[model samples]
Target: MQKRILLSLIVLLGACSTEKPDTVSIESQDDMKHASSVAANSTENREEVSLSLLEKSDSKYSYKLNGMKFSSNDRVLKKGSVVQSLSESGSGLIKGSFVVIASQLPKGVIEHYEVNEIATSTYRLIPLEIGGDLYELYQALRQNDVFSRVEIEIDYSGKQTSDSF
Candidate 1:
């Protein structure tokens, strides 16, 4: 009787452990699927916004911005001259970042902006000045009809000029 009771207890414990692992595996798989779906939706939304911007500009050009390339049909705008704008600048400190003043953005297009992540619109400010290469980006954004204003923030407080005695 004692041996039978011990065997039954051991079997029940083993079965419970195995069931827990399967449950965890299923939950993890579901989480991964949900994440993938969200990522796909985000990309689709961005593509839609890009297409609409191109339509609004009525340009015939292809350009790459933020690692994504798209084409437009407006001849007046130069190739690789336009960048999509974001609504809210991202969180964190940004030193010497470019500020893009543009017309009202389309709905469902606003996203967080990261520091030094090239975008037409950003609101964060930092102490460091922007790099020279980004000047071209700034120019492109400024020239685009979508943006009414584009300029880099210059933090003058850090500059120390010495006069010769």
Candidate 2:
């Protein structure tokens, strides 16, 4: 009886120790292909455009790139009707800041900037007080080739008021 029990234990242990061949599920394989294709298409569509500084003053600066206007004031970066408000009234000041809307951002750029993800693929980037200038950040974004659209806020002279948050 002892010999039989010992043999049974050895057989059970041997079966448990056997290694199965490494395999990936079909769903995971399909997912990987889809991700790679998306990345490839995004890189293929990337094109560099000339970013020109239009005007600069003590309080604000205006820039133009590919027929889109961008303006930055003491607090926020504006593009078209979208205003990415960086600081609230009486809050700490933010400088050398901007917004980038893209499907994906590089790991290095994400580490360098103080990022706020306002929505899916939309990011508000605030630079540190000492380093990472606005133009440098913009160039980084362009180099990464992730942005679907370049939309910068244009200031309107008409008075505007917001009653709801």
lDDT of 2 by residue, 1-165 (tens): 999999999999988866887895646877999888988877665522112222324345544432444434523332222322333212112234456778887677666767788888888765544443444455556656677654322223332432111
TM per candidate comes to: 0.26, 0.35
Weakest 10 consecutive residues of candidate 2 by summed lDDT: 47-56
Off by more than 4 A, model 2:
1-66, 69-95, 129-132, 150-165
Best candidate, TM-score-wise? Answer: 2
Q: What is the C-alpha RMSD of each candidate to the true structure, in Å?
A: 19.3, 19.5
Q: Compute the lDDT of residue 131 as modeled in candidate 1.
A: 35
Q: Local error of candidate 2 at 99, Å?
A: 1.9
lDDT of 2: 0.51
Query: Per-residue CA lDDT of candidate 1, range 19-122, in tens?
Result: 43444343587788987899999999999999999777655554333333434343232222233323222211112345655545423223323334345554
